[model samples]
Target chain A: MNHNLPVLVLAFPLLAAFAVNLLGKISKKHVAPWTLASLILSAGTSLWVLKDVLQNGKFSYTVGGWMAPYGIELVLDPLSALMLVMVSWVALIATFSALPSIKKEMPGREHLFFSLYLILICGMMGLVITGDAFNLYVLLEITSITTYGLIAMGKGRAPLSSFNYIIMGTIGACFYLLGVGYLYLLTGTLNMADIASRLPALYESPTVATAFCFLIVGVWIKMAFFPLHGWLPNAYTYAPKGASVLVAPLMTKVSVFLMIRIMFSIYSPEYDFLMHLGIKNLVVWAATIAIVGASLIALTQKDFLKMLSYIVVAEVGYMVGGVWLANQEGLTGAIFHILNDSLMTLCFFLVASAIAYRTGSSRIADFRGLFQKMPLTMLALSVGALSVVGVPPTCGFFSKWYLLLGGVEAGQWEFVAALIFSSIVNAVLFYRVFEVAFSHSEEEPSLKFENSRILETSPMMIPPLVVIPVVLLVIGLSAGPLVREVIRLAVPAL
Target chain B: MDAWLFEIIGKFNYWIYVVLMMTGFYAMIRKNNLIKKLLGMNIFQTAIILLYISMGSKVGGKIPILDKEQALAGAVQVADVVNPLPHVLMLTAIVVSVSVTGVALAVALRIYKEYGSIDEDQILERIGKS
Candidate 1:
């Protein structure tokens, strides 16, 4: 049972997805509990797997008793084990906040939403653990298709945005497939470890070069890095609040994880940094542009959720840029940021969804006097906002600090400047929202404290909201140990 | 020049796939109608499928099967059989493509119902007005 923990982590949610759909035929009430139980089981197993990997070094599990280099393999190094734990636990927390939103937004479709939701979680779990290049593409599509379905369930303009995402996402997936095909043609193996072993000799070949470009670009498009990010903001913004809360935090961050996997696992740092020096600088520059541009745009948004979407765009820039800095600190910051950014994004989106759930509005103007109306939710938003702005004692600040240190070491002053500028812009953006929420307006007397009792959101939403801020600080205070123990082990030799 | 021509002709399958993929990509980006974009996406995915299938084929190679007696006697030769992995992989790809098409069509149908048109320009106008 201990040996099979990796497969069990994926199996729980996948089986629960089917169970939820079937049981919903009789009653919709079973969907939430079933989904929660499966995610908890999956997350629990993932944590156990992480503990095992940490206690003992890395290990691999072959699917069904078939051997590697032929059958599918699930590799559980510290890196992937950490990612598995992150994706599962984040999905679990997001689901807690999502249930009530789903209940309120689309009442009768609870089972359908959670069914797709659980499958998406399963797909992400599979994605982080699978050792086959082609299997990653399949799991990517599974996550993507379910996301498209979940987003299209929104009331208006959502189907259109989801359709656009399908176009971009399919192109990205196909490009990745084409790259894997090229690798297979050269190495005659589908396993990532086997391909990596064979890649050294073929590094100088033009075919190898083309495959590398295709793979990186494919992943970039999926993660919404810079110019390829056109599909993200709209798809996320227009999605149902429940779906957005889950998808917004996890999707791009998981794709960033894939990029890191490709860079370190399949192709070594020597190949990525030394051989392709020009391309490395080019990517960092692109990340700089992404950061500055997205932050500037984020400052101009009037809608709260739309603003957060652009900030997501900038956070992708941070991770991508950090990786391209091509040093130990940069890579560590990037991997650590994957964990921190996902939690921070989840925190922000949860608060946004909670606000939208009770008020039926996400406009900044509607947030006026929200502090008086819902003090706890506003406090969560404040903590999330400070984290996003890179305030000290929060998880976001430490990752940004590593990123900045990495940028300075690499002498990429532009990237460093861009990171600082984005942080300031984030500070301004959140401050504006806070100012609006705190100010008293005489025109809207209905929102005044005297008119109505101050009420928080539903009981369902409060737990995750409270849990995330504490987790952020806990992760923040322990950043030193986390980086030294897990992340340092995860980073491949430079 | 002749060597270049021979090289191009030798991998004519890949060239054709590149052409198909680009055509589909263009339609996906450049076309106005949502259905046309979906059609382009199909063409793009099909080209990839064909590329993978072509990769699996070998000259004069038989289906990837082993004779029972030959396997027992340890006389099977790898060169005699074509690769089966790519085909199996592409089978999954085809299933994914079909699922994607189904989802895209469903989303397009919803778009048509909501805004009363699937044209990109018209949908934009409607969204703007709304």
Candidate 2:
């Protein structure tokens, strides 16, 4: 049972996805409990796997008892194990808010939505755990296809945005497949470790370089890294509240994790960082522009959800830039930021959904006097805002600090400047929203609830919004130990 | 010049696939109609599938199945057998592409229902007016 835990972490949600759909045919009410129970089980199993990994160092499980290099394998190193925990737990927490939001916003599509939701979670979990390059491509498609379905389920312009995403996402996944094909042609192996072991001798070949470029570019498009980010803002902004809360936090973060795996695991640091110093510099500079540019664009958005989506783009820049800084600290910050950013983004999206549920608008102007109407929700937003701005005592501050240290150490002053610039822009953006929400407006009345007895937000929604901010503070305070124990182990030796 | 010509002709398969890929990529980017874009995506994926299939093929290679008598006699050379892994991988890729195309068409249908037009410009113009 202990040996099977890693696969079990994935199996629960994959099985639950089909089960939920079938059960939904009988009654819609079974969907939420079924999805949540499976996610909880998956998260618990992931934590157990993380504990087992930390103790035993690293291990790989070959599917069907076949040996590595030939059969599909699921690897559980500190990094992947940590990512499993993060992805599962975040999926679980996001579902708490997602349930009520789906019920309210989607209305009667709960079964279908939750079914795709579980499958998306399963895909992300499989992505982090799988050791085969070809397997990763399949899981990427699974995630992308489910996300497209979820996004298109939204009313109005959503299907259009999802269609655009489908085009870009397919291109990205195909590029990755093409890259893997090139690698297989050269190395004759689809297993990641096998490919890596065989890659050093062929590092100087242009085919190898081209393959690396394709893989990185593919992941960048998937993660919405700057120039390839055109599909993100609109697709995420127009998605139904339930879907956005889950996809916004997990999708890009998992892709960044994939990039890290490719960089340090598949291709050695000597080849990625040392041999390609020129390309490294170019990517870092692009990340710098992505950070500053996305933040500036985010500042220009009047719709609050659109602004948050752009912030997600800039946050991607932070992780990408940090990783490209090519130091231990930078990698640590990048991995740690994956955890912190996902939590904070979940917090913000949950709060946005709750507010939208009440007020029926996401425009900044419509948020006037919301603080009085929804105090707890507003407080959660404040916590999330401070975290995004990298204020101290939230998890965001620690990761940004590590990223800054890495930038300074690497002598990338422009990237460092961009980081600081984006944080300030975030501060201004959140402040403007807060100022509107807090200020008393004589012309506009406070938002009225349909039922006087009910709370500001749904009971289902309130728990995650409240829990996430607390988790942020807890993670912030324990950053030192987390870095020393887990994240440090997760970072590849540079 | 003779060697360069030989190189181009010898690897002409790759060149053809790259051309096909570029054409699909062009349509995916430049086409106005959503259905055309979807077709472009299919073309792009099919080109990749063909590229992978080409990689598994050899000029004089047999299908991966082995003759038991030849295998027992130890007369089968590894090079004589065409690689089967790429073919199998492409099968999975084909399924994924089909699913992606199916989802794309469904979304395209939804887009038409919502905006009453499938052309990018018309949809955007409608969105702006609304």
Candidate 3:
């Protein structure tokens, strides 16, 4: 209940990561349990923090008791508390699944892998919890740096992937820093709340306008928003499955959260002159092009991971477009879709991991007769695919429903069309994989590649199947309550 | 003499910072060699350090000293004080930036070990062959 819970959520993983690094040097056996325990504890802390935030009002805890605008501060309101719970909880599931996969994919780097993994989790938690602007840039670096470490642990083309990631990520952070410099020059403040308070008086300045553009562009690069997403497909494709599943599911979504905070809270909707700077127009068009362009590109990829990478490009569009609509339904949809997209991508990547584990390949062609060998895995993939396609009763459908409604309310039928178009493209792309998995390959002549690997299942599939369906259900069943709260907070601004 | 040197040093530091930052960015983008790219990253991060230290300067300013005499005298005026806040913040930022560069270099070393070449085009060719 104390505001210290927010700090604890970050501190536990960070300390555990350091301990795990030490323990790992002595004996690798301790790495798995230590990592799991640390992550699960973080998840528990987030849940408790969420409960406290809902029961109480917004609470702030200054790091080192230095007070706001001077000392660093962490705040737990509904938005951040919910994000912490989702991220840490999902991180636990991902870590649970990471164990066997990491052992197989990267046998030598268990200690470094888990330590970097926890560091990344700490960074994301810091990004969500901290109320300081410049501090957010520091936290963003923490996550980005750890992500490079994780990706570098992969086997094939990993270094190059990490290199590309480093280049893009450094540019993103630089853009953010430059923007922070502009804000400081104008307001001479570094705190988000302080900046918000001061920005209104300087709303008409070209510097403020420039600052907002840099900040948005920086966040967009971090999120891998389209046209700036050149680094993503290769990075995700080459990274170890353990790291890919963790990052591909959550990192961009967290960056998107920062973008939303910058847009709504720091910019403060009441500033009429700044609000007229045409950010909404820029976001809407960027999202529109991303949705159409990414879907088209995804349709052409033959590699499994590469296809999923392109799909991520499309998914970013869905979230960004929802935010730019600037209406209740749109914002609610954007918020709720963050959950849906995370779970859906988790399901997708987990299935990709399973397929790679069995066949030692990630090519779409490798999926022929997959259903015969791995029935349960295929079924999980089907659910993930259905969700991606926005099929009814799944979480993805509800997300798209809200997004579409938002678009219509904003009189942007073109965006609604783009959403539907992407969904249809998803159906086509995933169904092709499905059809291949269902049928026997015609290439084999005399002897069939024996289905000797009975079921071809792993210990990793359990958490994903168990949790992903429930997530889908929760999105549908709890949409009313989630939307209500989002409306409550956002209505005043609108 | 101290004031004159401080003015010259403060302005000179900024030019080096901007040039180094640009150099690092150029090498990172222009070169195909992974190790050189990491060297560039180190330079880029060094530029941020210079920026922070520049922000910390105040002409004829003393280091932050807390004593009963100074506090009672109220001698810590804005004009006579260096802003140590940016320096402290920069200290944290420097540690993080170095750690990042360390990891990036580590990854580059691993890449060299695996592919037998740190050149991007050569590595891509090897992967394509595989």
Instruction: Tell me each candidate's i-RMS in Å.
Output: 0.5, 0.5, 1.5
- Candidate 3 residues A281-370, lDDT tens each? 667878999999999999999998999999998999999999888888888888888878888888888888877776767888778878
**Global lDDT of model 3:** 0.83
Looking at model 1, residue A86 earns an lDDT score of 95
Q: In model 3, which regions exceed 4 Å deviation? A: A272-274, A441-454, A485-492, B1-23, B66-68
Question: What is the overall TM-score of model 2 with all chains considered together?
Answer: 0.98
Model 1 has an lDDT value of 0.91
Per-candidate local distance difference test: 0.91, 0.92, 0.83
| Models sorted by lDDT, best on top | 2, 1, 3
Clashes of each: 0, 0, 0
* DockQ each: 0.93, 0.93, 0.49
Q: What is the lDDT of residue A474 in candidate 1?
A: 90
| CAPRI band for model 3 | acceptable
- State which candidate has the highest lDDT: 2
For the candidates in turn, chain A alone yields TM-scores of 0.97, 0.98, 0.95
TM-score of each: 0.97, 0.98, 0.92
